[model samples]
Target: MKKLNYLLIAIFTLGLATSCDSSDPAIIDEDDNQSGTTITKAGLITANETWTADNIYVLSGKVVVNEGVTLTIEPGTIIKGAEGQGSLASALVIDQGGKIMAEGTADKPIIFTSVLDNITVGQKKGSNLTIANVGLWGGVIVLGKAPISVSGDLETKQIEGIPATDSFGQYGGSIANDNSGVLKYISIRHGGITIGSDNEINGLTLGGVGSGTTIDHIEVVANQDDAIEWFGGTVNVTNVVTYAQGDDAIDADEAWSGTLDNALVIMGADSDSALELDGPAGSAATEAGYTIKNVTLKGAGASSVSKYADLRDGLIANLQNILAYDFGPTSVVKVNGADSATELAAGRITFLKWEIVLPAGVTSVSSLITGANAGDDTKFTNNATAITAASAATVGANTAVFSWTYAKSVSAF
Candidate 1:
């Protein structure tokens, strides 16, 4: 896991190298047959057709994806959202059974950022990384039929906050063999609105996605909510990063059965927990079981509370080979319920032999493990033994470190 500074510097250097060959030979070849009219609003993008962000496609409403269609975005293309356009001005949305083959190379990754780009020498304003600055103004939403348990009835329900419910919104489908598309080497910056208390669209929302969907090398920066929200699916993700999110870094609920490996999260001073696993407590059977490995979480201040908070029923979270540092007064690991504590201690919620470098004045793992019925020690030791066995050979390897400037950067809103 490379540090944040190293990653940014590497990207910046790569940007300079590729800034010269910004030509699209394919554009000229394809435009010869198609009309020269520019697309400025939402519309169905056909398969085998190459789409470019001419004047920043403002999605005033839902963008539908017809079956057997594929939407391909060119590399180095910038998609900007409208500030006043509410939540529809954002970039592309992949409807159920539709595919988005946004294959951006390391040298030419597609960037979805805020429209505001004016900046002074040392000032940071109107940048795409602000939580409230909803430029191009909405995030990305992918709806599929991949085995998901919704909070409400599985009848015809609207995705809250997104208008035009009848047009592009889905009405539920079979979870078998549901395929969205492949998303790799893409960056979603400056998204997530303050929709209301504890409810805002994230940088990327995978709703009812299935195992057939492909996800890799994704990054979310400065989102108002969790960088990535998994609603119910068997999606497997690798090499993911989240930076400066206002809420949790990664949130999973509604019976989300997924595998997350090699995740790096660097939190700001005001950000919330690193991982939050909660099923609507009122509906426990709907919660999902998650398996996670090789996670590195680093927070800035005491404001950086718990790394893992479990509030779900039948939440079987197996965390192994983790390294957490710079925590506040709270525990590095906390199970919100007494029963959860028991399960966690009894090696059920296994926390493999790990290391935590606490802040200068704090040294206690007791607060992290509260509630008991007398068999607490056996559970704790069991968890420790499991951790030891799993993490004997590889521990504290490649911890991610981040160094960012606090200077206020601005983007058009």
Candidate 2:
């Protein structure tokens, strides 16, 4: 873990170097206008640590829970991430074999946001930031020793957001049922800190997570990148809401074979695709198909971008029971020409019961299908049926579970 510690040490040093900045990056025991103690966390946590609701936690730098360590956060606890970029970004990383017992209930959910946020103790959200504000800090990255379909037949690969020099950033193994622990009813906001060009930390990045881990009732608001990106994980998620994302709302890559059930996506300004689905990179988990169901996508953003699924890499997927509406005129459910067409013919890809309220001047669902290859679009678009907005509301995500989210408070639902 020497190399891993060095990775965090670099971030710690960077935080100290930026303490004189105008934002006045938070330090330990600083009066952040919050109640109780402000526990500043940085670098490696080698032993078990429990964060109670009585105090607030601040991630001053890249705080990593080392292998065999357990970092538990009590419900109603508020944790903030310090502002930084690249190697200096502040984030909470659960390395392979580390466990995070951060289980928050519907009534008292855990909150993860930027240190610049004015929200303090016992508050769900702050007035200083809105859904439009983003990239204030880094987000959560959880890695595990599970199977991933990388280019080589490798046992592990470094997660993308972390620099390659850090060996602790590596994730993946033969542990199909690896236990990383539980994350429920948590809201990650104003994250997706920039790492490099076109590379930013996702709101919640699950790299090679396994089925033994539990992630449910999660809400990501104002994430600068993908709200939740699964890089080759078999862990199923439930009841998620992602709103005001600057990039793709949901993304899955490297043969993530799991189900994302009951999800709600509300795209904001500068957002792109509602779904960016990528297939396996290599031979591993090729037969395992991705399953996503029960989604409500509202493409209400001003920006005319990739408004639908951008399927690529010869994915074998199943998307069902979706209700999408209010998209721009240019958006389409894109498929990569012949590869997706071939997959559809081979029964590797399927779509079921998609209901969309077509934008004005579009009278049919067939107009929504587009791809570099002409033949595939027709077949893929056949699953979609046009419906009225009134009937469209009856389908997709159970908004009741997202009552604790900041999105709900702002009526983003």
Candidates' C-alpha lDDT: 0.56, 0.83
TM-score for candidate 2, please give it.
0.90
Residue 278: error of model 1 in Å?
Answer: 2.3
Best by lDDT: 2
User: Model 1, range 1-413, lDDT digits (tens) per residue?
Assistant: 33455456545645543453321111111111122222333445445465563323334344555556787776544554446444444545676767777775555555665546332212222343354443235577777776555555462234433554345545234573567888776667777765555545678887767777788767777776677887766677776777677778888765666778877666756567787765432243333367777776666656656454434443566677666665666644545666566555555565675555555455444445444445564343344321222133344323231112121122110
Candidate 2 wrong stretches, greater than 4 Å: 1-34, 301-303, 372-375, 390-394
lDDT of 2 by residue, 1-413 (tens): 75465456656755674665323323344333337556677777778889888778889777888899999999999999998888788899999999999999988899999999988778888889987789889899999988889998777888877888765788888888999999999999999977878577999999999999999999999998889999897888999999989999999988889899999998886888899988888877558588899999988743456567888888889988888887877778887657766676677877888888877777888888766354655555777888988254657777777778888898886
State, as a TM-score between 0 and 1, how close model 1 is to the true structure.
0.73
TM-scores for the candidates:
0.73, 0.90
Give model 2's clash tally: 0
